[model samples]
Structures are given as structure tokens and as C-alpha cells.
Target chain A: MKALVHEEKTGTKGLSYREIAELEPNAGEVRVKLKTAGLNHRDIYTLQRHKPTDPPLIIGSDGAGVIDAVGDGVSDIQVGDEVLINPGLGWKEKSDAPPQGFEILGLPFHGTFAEHVVIPAENVVQKPQYLTWEEAGVLSLAALTAYRALFTRGQVQSGMKVLIPGIGSGVATFLLQFAKASGATVYVTSRSEEKCRKAVELGADKAIDSNGDWHEALGGEKMDLVIESVGAATFNKSLDQLRLGGTMVTFGASAGDVVQLNIRNFFYGQFNLLGSTMGSTEEHREMVQFIEKHQIRPIMDHMYPLSQFEQAFERMEKAAQLGKIGFHIR
Target chain B: MKALVHEEKTGTKGLSYREIAELEPNAGEVRVKLKTAGLNHRDIYTLQRHKPTDPPLIIGSDGAGVIDAVGDGVSDIQVGDEVLINPGLGWKEKSDAPPQGFEILGLPFHGTFAEHVVIPAENVVQKPQYLTWEEAGVLSLAALTAYRALFTRGQVQSGMKVLIPGIGSGVATFLLQFAKASGATVYVTSRSEEKCRKAVELGADKAIDSNGDWHEALGGEKMDLVIESVGAATFNKSLDQLRLGGTMVTFGASAGDVVQLNIRNFFYGQFNLLGSTMGSTEEHREMVQFIEKHQIRPIMDHMYPLSQFEQAFERMEKAAQLGKIGFHIR
Candidate 1:
């Protein structure tokens, strides 16, 4: 199998393309011949040596492909069936299952940044007919994330005001579309003027510049929900702009994780500060349903063949693209 | 008219035992001759000037008294009927109607720290016959607080483990009795060993200290509910000790208000951090039932005459008292 593997932590090509031995699937496992794999900022973080030190680490988390093989007692799928590998196999289909520590694809384990990756049968969801290979591959992470944070945890509702802090980030883009689909009033901010305009074109009710003072500009009326990926620097400001009893859903910490808040504001006005991680498997299924129903599409600035992996990493490191920048590995 | 006025930002003696102009009942108002007044920490906050200062601020919010006079067209009660003032009064009530915001006593409003308080007729809940003046007075804030935070917001259940950060704080005592009545495994903590032992006698399963590695002492078993009045320094420790999908209610920040948290922990684990100000008037009625049904008696530490208020406050300031430190004005 010709796969991208990080040898020594240097640059993006720290992952030198090489032919590696493909392993046989274990019992209850299925091997996926990847058609397309999505790249995320997390992959870039690992490339920059932000992740645990391990040579030959496989990087991509989200992907879609055809099933190549099914292990013993796997009555699940036959060869040639197209599917979406749920990026995180450890996400329990059973709601009552206990937590499986460190299971996200690409983070602590071998990932989809390869020609083939083996996973348990439960991690595979049938990709909807409406989506392309590239779309299905990328949808697992971003769409499901937005689904869980906004719907299940955030309890977002129709006709409510929702604010997303930045434009063109994968999660932010998905939030914009998903919120609109749910009948919420979506507002966004962007460091790039063009991205702001693009967000509005993509269903955001309003898009402001990066430095735009959202709290004051919105006057005394505050948002019902705030999707905060950027942290620290914007945390207090985010809390300030939420309506009394409104919730702030924090998923990422592009800024710093630690933040301080005035406790009185929470009690007197009734505010909730909710922290969210990735979607549970059930939430991911919901994501697929929502995306297929609303015809929501992820924004991919560029798509390349697996061979151009180095170039893709460079663009991602510089953030020179909008939304998820990825590669197909067939 | 006589009122215990705080002339300057000083302890106990700040209560200037002086005469002031009488305030007549305005429209929709009634004058009550107070029999018993409850003490909330907010009054202390006002005295110490931790809260914003405007001198001559009337103290006390929770009051049980006789309706001495009803202003024009006020027919809710005839002269001399016993009632408990609904301190947080947010809505108007019919003459034969129910009380509205009954739980928010001793906040910014002109409270009942004196012999007479003029408020709208709607601000009163008819006193149940079984309660004594002291029981009726103290039940409004602390008792209702525990009910709302534990059962209402925290949704505690029988056999569930509940952790209250303090042993004898006004709310903590009520929480201890309430959780025990609800069949919960109640745990309390205090800096004082004596206080911890006393709390165990008051129905706490265990009383941990706020000192040296108390979290490890909790055996890593997650709590179902944690009632937090102490804030900042203890928030993370509480969060860490909570199980997945556990609820932490923050109603007061006795230690400090500002706190930091990792948002992901809250969202992914389905952790809930609810901020409760004061429960509704219905909650006050519920607390009244709870107290009478449970025959719960507040832990009255000592009684000080109005003139000895400084001594009472000194006890509170030193955290020497296990229960409410009160002053009698009558």
C-alpha cells in the first residue's frame, strides 16, 4: 500500500510517500480502500509536531471508500459497497456504552491518510446517494460535529439568533448551513472580507469583519446561541453578547483553552457555558440525515490527488484556503 | 420611621441605628409590620461593599410580617394577616391571586431589614400555620435555594450522590436536609474539622475538607450532582469529580466569581453547568411544603439583638458560625 507516513517531524513531507505492507483484517473488522480522504487543521497540527511523538503516524481522520474485505463473522457488508468510515470507530452506537478513551481517528491511532485502513463494522455508515466520494469523506467530521454541538448539546432552535465567530473554518461553514437549515438566524465573522461575503452568500444572515464589535453592533439584543471555536481572547466578549439564559457552545480552542468569566453574569442573567467535543455516533447518523435532507454541502477550496500531499499540507499550514483542503487516496 | 441603615461601608456598626423619614405606601403598595426577617449573604455583601455601593441602601429582603395597611384599592389582605414577602417580585398578582417572584430576597431591592417594608401586595405568600416566625423567615432564601438547585435544576434522585462544597453555609444546611429527605447520599465539605463532623451529624454521608488534596480523597467516584456556592478555586475540582452527564449548579460565588474551564469537558461528557439565581415563587411555595413536610429546622447558631449586629457579623466574617448569623430588630 502506498501511503503518506510521517518519518521525522520536519515539514509536511515529514510524511514521505512509501509503499507499506497492507495487513489482513482481524475478526469483526473491515478493510476500506479509500477513494477520498479529507484534511483538517488537526492533521496540520500533527505535522507541525503538536501531536504525540510517533514516527510513521498516519494522519487523515475523515474519509469514504469502497469496502475491500470483511473479516470473520462480519455479516455486515460485502465487497464493492461504498461507505463512510465514521472517522471515530470508538464512538458507541449504543448510547449506554461507557467511554472508550482516545478513539478519534488520526489522533491516537492509525488513520485514513492512506490507501487502505481497517476498522470495525460499526464504524461504517452507508454514504447517501446524493453525496460524492469527496463530500462523503469530509462530511463525517465537520457535519457530525455541527450536528452534535448545535442540536443535541446546544439545543438550537428555529428562529433563534445564532452567532458563529469565524467564516470558512470547516466547523464554522457547517454551522452556518446547519443553523440556517434548522431555521435559525445565522450570523458570522471573518478575518477576510471575501470570506464574510461568501458566508452571507451561503446562508448567513449577516457577516461582519474580524474586528467588528458584535456586542455593541447587535445593540442590547444578544444571541440565543454562540458557536465559539476561537477561545480566550473572545471568551469574555462571547459571554457578553449572549442573551440572558443563552448558551455558548465551545468546540475548539484555536486561541487559548483557559478563560475567566464573571460568575455573577451567569447567575443573575441565567447563562450557560457549555463545552463540547466531537459528535457521538448517533449524532453522526443524525448529521447524515440532515445534510442529505437539506442538501447541505461542505466548502472545499481545492481537491488534489494523493500524490500532491505535500502541497496540500503547505496550503493548510498557511491557512491559504477556505474550508477543508483535502486529497483523494484510491 | 425606624430602619437599620448602613451609613458607611463598615461592619455591624454600619447599621446606623437612626431615625429616617417614613415612606408611605404608594399605588399597588402595602405596609407590613415585620415580625421576622431572613438574612441572606447579599445583605453582608452590601455592607462590606463587595457589591456596587450607593449609600443609604435599605437592607433585608426576606420578611414575614403582618399586613398593617393596604394602600388605595389594595385588597389582597386585610390588616393583621400574616404573610411572607415574595422578595424577587417580577409580576403583578390579583388580590385573590398567588405570589410571584418569592425567592429573591436581600438582593438590590429595598429589603426587610427593618420593622416595616413597603412593597406591592403581590409580593406576599400567605404563611402556613405550622411555621414559626424564624422558620418562615429563613425558609425563603436558603431553603428555596436548595430546593431549586438540587431538585429542580440539578434534578437529584433518591440514592444519588450529592456533593455540597460547604457544610453550614445557609444554602448548604438546607441542601443537607433536603438531599437527605430526597434519599440522596449527601456529602458536605468544610475547612473546619469540627464543622465537618457537625455536618455529618446533620445527615451528610461524609464531610471532606477544602484543604490538601481533598479530591483524591473522594475516591475518583463521580458525583451525580454538586451544589456550588464556593467558586473560582473550586470550580475545576468540582468539575473533575463529576461523572459524565452530571449537573453542577452555581448559585453563589462566595469565594470569587471568575472561573476558567475547558469547554470540551462540558459538552462531550454531557456535563451540565447550570447557573441558578433564585427559584420562582412556585419554588417558594414548594420550599414551604418541603420544610413543613420534612419538619426541617434551620441550624440557628446564635441570636443577637439589633444593637449587637457587629458581634453577629464578626461571627459570620470569621466563618465561626455553622448556621445563619442573625439579628433581632423587634
Candidate 2:
């Protein structure tokens, strides 16, 4: 099987396309003949920071495929079933912590940037029928993150005001859609005017320039919830824009993590800063159902064949893509 | 009326004992002849930072007194009634934000540090009969902050592992009592061993040295909730000690507010950092009832006459007191 394998945990330069030994389903697992795979910033972090002591790794956390085989005692799912991988392994239900042995796909274990991947049978949910193969491939990681941050943590409601900062990423796009579909007044910010306009076109109530004064741009409309993945550069500003007692759910910190915060203002304003990651399996299923229910579709930027891995990496490195960048795997 | 006033916004040195104009009750307000007044860090902040534009400002937020007079339309409270001033004015009910014109007492308006303090009638709750005047005077601000942090934001539960960092402050002392009364396994940390020992004597399950390695001391017992008031120095360490999805409520930052945080760890752990301040009137009422129900006594460290306020402030500045410092007012 062909896979995009990193020989060393360096940077994109360490990535190479080569033939690797085909994987097989272990007990209670299923072999997925992946049709498509998606890129995420986590993959970039794993490449740049994972220790060299770590084993050679395949990178990718999201994918859609058909199951080729099922291992012993795998009774719920059958071979050839269309499914979406729940990327987050071992967190089967809602819990305060992910279960021991929990690892997202594509780090310690082989991931979807390969022709075939074996995952726990339980990690695969029947893919939402309304989504295309490309859409399903890119939806899980970003959609689940947005779902948990908005619904599970932020508790976003129909009339609540929501703000999504740095709105060009796959997760931010999905957040904009999910919040809009839920009847929230969605406000978005992006460094790129093009992305802001795109967000407004996709039902965002307002789109503001990230480089501008957000407080001035929003014009006194404070957010009840802020989905903040952009760190240091925008974190304090995000804090400033929340209504008293409002929540900011932070899942990623792409720019940097060193944030300057006035503890006095935070407490006096009564803010909640919640940290979130991937969702539980239950939330993953609900995310798929929610997208289906709202007819939500992943905003595709571009797709490349598995062979053009460097091109995909280059596009993401420049952040030139508006939405998800994918690889046609099969 | 005699009052402890800060004639300028220049730290504790600016505070002076002086005779000020006697205050009169306004429409829908009452004038209380303060019997005892408690010192809070917030009072210090006001003295140190609030503009001199509000000069001759009386300084103190927590007090118990006999209502000396009531203005017209003041129906719920009457003259000569004993009460504890809520301190947080204009926020009469639960709100995501304080009502317009919301302000803590002792800032722009004359506050409890004076011989007579005038406040809105709704801001006074009848003092609990079980409490000593000293206890009632010191209980409102700190107890309300702790109540909102633990029960309102932290959502603490019976048998949950709770950690209170920097455990010698008025609020930390009340938090320890409140959590213990609610059947929680309360753990405490303080730079001073004597304070830790005092916490244990007051029913804390364990007390650790804040300067020591807390993770090793706890022996793998992760905290479900952390009451964090010590800032910059302990914020990152507090994040490290919380169990996944745990909540940390921060209401003060005596150490400083600038702190280094690893964003990856925060989001991956799915922790919550909630910022709280003095609570609403409803919560203040609830706090008073809770104390009465539990028969919890406010920990009194020392007391001085109103003229010795500078010495009291010195004791607090040195962090020498284990609990609350109060002034015996007339």
C-alpha cells in the first residue's frame, strides 16, 4: 500500500511518498479502503514537534472510506459499508478525560494518508448519506471540534451571539455554518477580506477584518460565545469582545500561545475560557447527523492526487486555501 | 462622619484617616451606621488604582451595621434594622452582565469604611442572626466570590476533589469551609506552612506547599475543580494540576496577571478557566443562607480600630494574616 510517511519528525521536508507494507484488521478492527483524506494543522504540528525517538508515522486525522474487512467479534459493522472514521480513538462516550490508550488517528498508529487503514470497528460511523466522498473525508476532525466547542462546551443557543476568529480554516468554516444553522447571530473575523466576504456569503451575520479594531467593527454587540483557535495574536481581543459571563472555547492556537491577559478585567467581566479538543464518539455521530439535518456541506478549496503531497502541503503552508484541502486517496 | 479615605489613587500610602461629610440616604436608599468593616484586596486595588477623580472615596466593600435611616420608597428595608450590605450595587438580580451604572461600593460612592454609609435599599440583606457583627461585616464580599466560583462556575459536587491555591485569603478560607460543608475532599496549597496547617485544622483533607511539586505531593490525585486566586506564578501550574475537563475559577491575581500558558496542553486537556468577581444580589442572598444553614463561621485573624487601618493594610500587604482583617467601626 502507498502511504505518505514521515521518515523523521522534522518538517514537510521529511515527508515522502513510498510503498509501505499493507495493514490488516486486528481483533475488533476494520480495514478501511480510504477513498479520500484531509489535511489539518495537527498533522503539521505532529511533523514539526514529534520527537525523533517516535516511530516513523503516517499523518492525517480525517478520512472517509468503505470498509474492506472486519476482524473477529466485529458484529455491528460489515465489510463494504460506507463510513467516516471518528479520528479520536478510545473516547467512546462523554467523559471528563479521554480514556487511557486514547490517541487520534495518524500519530502512534498509521493514519488515513494511506491507501488502506485499519481502525477500531467502533470508530467508524455510517457516513451521512447527503455528503459527498470528498466532504465526508474532510468533515470529521473540524466538524467534531466545532460541534463540541459550540454545543458541548459553549452551549450556543439559537439567539446567542457567536464569534469565530481566524475564519478561513476548515474548523472555523464549519463553526460558521453550524452556528448559522442553529439560528445564532454569527460574526466572523479573518485576516483576509476574501475569507470574510466568503463567510458572510455563507450566512454569517457579519464579517470583520481581523487586523482592524474588532471592538469598533462589532459596534457594541458583544458575543455570548467566541470560538477562538487563533491564539496570542487575537486571544486578548477575543476576551475583550465577550459580554460579561460569556464563554470562549479555544481548540487551537495557530499563531502562538504566549497571550497577555489582564486578570483583573477577566474576573470583573466574568468570562469563561474553555479549552476543547476532538469530540467523543457520541458527539461525532451527532455532528454527522447535524450536518445532514441542516444540509451542511464542507466547503472544498481544492483536492490533489496522493502523489502531489508536496503541493497540498505548500498550499496549506501558505494558508492560501479558503476551506479544506484534501487528497484523493484511492 | 469619620472614614478611611484615599485622597489619591496611589497605593496604600495614599490612604488617610479623616473626618468627612456625613452621608444622607437618597430616594430608594438607606444610610447604615456601620458597626464593623472588613478589608478586601479589592479595596486595596481601588485605593491603588481607581482615579482621584473620585477623591475622598471611602474604602471598604464588606460591612454590617444598623440601618440609621431609610429614604422614601424604601419598603423592603427599614430604619434601625441590622443588615449586611451586598456591596455590589445596581445589580439586583441574576444577569449575564451587571446592570447599567453597576459599581462596587467604596469607589465613586462613600462605602462601609465610614461611620455612616448610604446604599440602595436593595443592596442590603438582613444579617444572619447566627453571625457575630465582625463575621457578618467580613462575610459578604469574600464569601460571595467563593460561592459564585465554586457552586456557580466550578459546579462542585459531593466527594469531588477540590483544590484551593493560596489558601490564606478571606475568600480562600470561606471556600475551604464551603467545600468541606458540601462534602467535597478539599485540598489546599499555600506558600506558608502555617496557613496550610491552619487549613487542615479547619477540615481540609490535605494541605501542600505551593512552592513544592504539587503533582508529586497529590500522588496522582487530579483536582476536579481549582479555586485559583494567586495569578501569574500559579496559573500554569494550576492548569497542570486539574483533571481533564476540570474547572478553575480565578477571581484575583495578587501575584500578577501576565502568565505563560501552553495552549496545546490547555485545549488538549479540555479544562475550563472561569473568571469571577463579586456575585449578584441573588447569589449574595444565597451565600448568606448557605452560611446560616451550615453555621459556618468566618475565620477572624485580627481586628483594629478604624484609625489603625494603615496597620491593618500593612498586615494584609505582608500576607501575614491567615484569614480576614477587620476594623471596629462605630
Candidate 3:
């Protein structure tokens, strides 16, 4: 079996599609032949020297596949079962991870960007036969993040106002639909007028440009929850746009790194600044159930073959797409 | 009547004792003959021109007194009932406030440093008759703050590892006793050996010097709740000492303003940066109950005649006293 091996950690440019010796399942690990993989901006950070790891990085955090083999004492999963990989599943191993919290996949170790990814048995969750590999592969990170933001951290309620800074993100699109389905009025942002219009067609109550004029975008309305991933640029505005005592969950700071801390702003309004990370495994499992129960499908932007990983990454880098960028492994 | 009044819109130095027309209680007001006023560091900040209020400044926030009169529709207390003057009382007549957040006492309104003060009927709560007036004056801001920090915000449990950054604050002194009462192991920080010994006698399990070391103060241990108020000085270290999923509640920022955000510190450790204002009416009510039930008293450090308001402020500004500096009125 061969994989997308990286001699260096530089993201797209580091990959060398060459045949390597097949890896066998280690103790408590499962060897899965990946059918589909999802790409995220965090992968880019790892590649650009932000995340330091040993060479030959098999860097992918999100993937879905069939179990080719299971390590000794594996009790839950069987060979040939379809599954979605929990990227960061260490703490679930009942090992070093503290009780109730675990590590995320695709972060420090070899990821799922290849044909076969060896992961801990705890990291694999069974996927339904009815769902396509493409859907299963992209579901874990984006969907769980949105679920946590809307329900877990934010406490978004029916008839409440929620603002998503952009609708084109894999997570943002998930959040908009999730909020709307949960009886919330959704506000989306798009840099392009066309994309803004498209978001409205997709059930957004209002769509505004990603540009700084949010006051006019929503007619000077204050929202109950603001999902802020575009960190520095939209942060101050998010603070201003939220109703008093509202929550702003900052899970990602994509636009820029620095975030401002204004004591008077936070204290006077009684704001809750919750820094949400990826999410819990229990939350991820619940998210899958919710998506399935609601018949919700993540918005698909484009799909590519394994060899065209560079093309997919380039598109993401250019920010030209609408939803998730997926790769269908052949 | 004579009182200290600061124009809330301006930070000025001319806050002085002056005679003013006695105010009749409004429909939902209570008039009190203030016996003592607690001096807090926030008063200095208001004096430094923080609130943008005009000033012929009369500054004092925390107070204790006897009720003199009640307006129409007021039924709670009678003349001469001992009570605390909650300057930043939330819940009535003020909608711009966080439903029940801290009221900006003394800055925008005439304060307790005067002979008499008037406010909403709800702001006056019964003070423990046994407590000294100076002690009662300082009780709410620090004691209620400690209550909220531990039980309300931090939800501190029995047998938990707690790290407190400073033992000098009135809140810190209350926390030492409160944590011990809760059966928790409390470690406190101090630059003065005398203060440390006093904290130990009061109830601190261990007191460590902030002699340019983190692990030493921690006893090479991690904390479950970090009491942060020193702002940039201790903010970074507070986060480091917490266990995974631990919390740091910042109710005060005495060292300075401005806290830097280190993303990796947040993601890797699973820390929570909780911003707590003073508290709510419910919190205040609960704290009063706790105090009455436990017989906890504010450590009154110094007291002067009401005419020596400037002397009290000077002591607080110079950080020359521990616990509380208060004014005694006739």
C-alpha cells in the first residue's frame, strides 16, 4: 500500500506521492484504508512551520474509510466496517488524556491525508452505509464545531439572533443551517455580493458583506450569539453587535492572530468571552446523530482526486470556494 | 447634608466634602445616614478620569449605615435599621446595566463618604449588627466578590487545589477563610512574610512568596481555580498553574490593564479565562446569607473620621494598608 508521504512538513508542497512500506496496526490501533479525506486551514499552519513534527508527515486530520485490520484486543470495530476517524482521540484511550478530555487528531502526529492511515481504535466511529464517504470524511471537524458553538458553548435558543461572520466556511455554513433549523434567525457575512445573495437563498435571514460595516448590514441589530472565527478584523465589531450579556465564542482566529482585550467593554456589558477549542468526542457523536436525524447535508464546494490535493489546497488558499473542499480518494 | 459627589462623566481631582440640599426619597428610594464608606482601588481609577464624567468629585462606593427614611412604595426597612450601601446595585431603575451586574457607585452618583446617601430601595441590605461599621462598609464589594468567584463563577468544590495570586486584597482574605471552610487546600501568594503569616493564621493552607518564581509559589502543583486580579502581572502565570479544564476568573485588574492572548496556551491546556464583574443581586443576597450563616467578617485595616476622606484615599492609593480602608461617620 502507498500513501501521500511528506519528507518535509511544508503543507501542499511537501507531499511526495510515492510508494512506501505498508504499516500494520500497532497495539490498540486500527489500520484503515481511507476512502475520503477533508482539508482544513490548520493543515496549512502545520505545513508553514507553525506546527513542528518529525519528517514524513502523513498530515490529514479529517478522513473516512473502511477498517482493513484491527489491532489486538480491539472489541468495538471489525474489519470492513465503514467509519469516520476522530482526529484527536488520545484522551479517549483511557491513557494519558485527563478524565473527560482528549487530544485532537491531525495536530501533532501523522494525519489521514493518505490512502491508509493508522489511528487508535478509540478514534474510529462507525459511519452509516447509507452515507457517502465524501460526507463522512468532512463531517467530523466542521459539523461538530458548529454544533458546539450553537448549542454547547453559545446556548443559542429558538427565536434568538445568531451572526455568522462568513457563510463560505465549512463550519460557518454548518452553523447557519444548524441555527436556522433550531429556530434561530441567522445572519451571514460574505465578502462578495454574489455569495451574500447565495447565503440568503440557503436560508439565511440576512446576509451582509464581510467588510466592517455590520451596523448597517443588520440595521443596527444586536445578536444573542456571534460565532467569531475571523478573529481580529471582526472581533471588535462582534463585541459592538452583541446584545448586553450576550456570548461571543472565539474558536478560530483565521484573519489575524492578535485579539484585543478591553476590560471596560467586557465588564460593563457582562460579556462572556468563551474560547472554544475543537470540541468533545461526546459532542461529536451527538452532532452526527443530530445531522442524521435532521437529514442535514453539509454544503459541498468541490471534490478532487488524491493526486489533485495541490489543486484543492490552492483553491482554499485563494479563498475562491463556497463550502468545504473535499478529496475523493481513488 | 454633606456628601462626596463626583460628576460621573469626568475624572477630576477636586472631589471634596461639601454641603448639599437633603434629598427626599423618590417613589422607590431609600435615604440612609451613612456611618462608614469603604475605599477601593477602583475609586482611584475613577479619580484618574476613567468614566468621562464631570467632576466636582465626591467619591466613595462601599458603605454601611442606618436607614433614615423610605419613599412611597418602599416597605422593606424602617428608620434606624443598620444597612449596607451597595453603590453599584443592579435590578431596578437601571436598564443599561447587566440585568444584575455591578453598579458604578460613587463615580456617577454621590457616594457614602458623605453624611447621607440616597439610592433605590433595593440597594440597602441588612448589615450584621455585630460587625464594626468599618468592617460592614467593606464587606459587600470584597466578600461578595469572593463568594461569586468561588461558588458562583469558579464553583469551587471540596478538596480542590486552589491558587490565589495575592493575599493583600480584602477579597483574597475572604477567599482564604472561605476556601478553608469549604475544605479546600488554599495556596496564596505574597511579597511580605508578615502578610503570609497573617493569612496562614486566618486560614490559608500554605502561603508562598512571589520571589520571582512560579513553581515555588505553587509548591510544584497545579490549581483547579486561579484567583486573578493583578492583570498582566499575574495573568500568564495563573493560566499555567491550572489543571486541564481549570478556570481563571478575573474580577479585578489592579496591577494594570491589557492582557495578551497566547493561542497555544489556550488550546493545549484547555483553560478558561472567565471575566467576572462584581456580581448580581442574587449573588449579593446569597453572599449576605453566607456571611450571616458563617459569621465571616471583613478584616478592617484602618478607619478615619468622615472628614478625613482624603486621608483614607491616600492610604488606599499608596497601597499602604491591608484589607480595607474606611471612613467612620457620625
The per-model DockQ list reads: 0.45, 0.74, 0.36
lDDT of 2 by residue, B1-330 (tens): 788888765887778888889978879999999999999988877876667665567788889999989998988887789998889987777665576788888887778998989888988889889899999888888998899888888888999999998998999999999999999999999999899889999999999999999999889899999999988888878878898888889888999977766776889889888888878888888888899999999999998999988889889988888889998995
Model 2: clashing residue pairs? none
Question: In model 2, how well does chain A match by TM-score?
Answer: 0.97
Candidate 3 residue spans exceeding 4 A from truth = A26-29, A48-55, A93-103, A106-110, B5-12, B46-58, B92-97, B100-104, B191-194, B209-211
How accurate locally, in lDDT, is each candidate? 0.76, 0.88, 0.75
lDDT of 2 at B294: 94
- Candidate 1 chain B superposition, TM-score: 0.87
TM-score per prediction, in order, is 0.91, 0.95, 0.90
Candidate 1: pairs in clash: A275-B263, A275-B267, B60-B111, B60-B112, B86-B123
Please report the candidate that would top DockQ against the real structure: 2
> Compared with the true structure, what per-residue lDDT tens digits does model 1 show for residues B265-288?
555566777777666667767777
| Local lDDT at A63 for model 2 | 91
lDDT tens string, model 1, A1-330? 988777666557577777877867899989999999998877766667633356567778888999999999889688888999787656665242227573678756678888998888878888898888888888777777777778877788999999898676788889988899999998887778888888888888888876777766666567989988877767777777777667888777766667776776787656776666677777787788888898877887788888888788778666566687768785
Q: Please give the lDDT score at residue B82 for candidate 2.
A: 95
Query: Residue B221: error of model 1 in Å?
Result: 1.8
Per-model RMSD to reference: 3.6, 2.0, 3.5
Error of 3 at A253 (Å): 2.6
Interface root-mean-square deviation for each candidate? 4.9, 1.4, 3.7
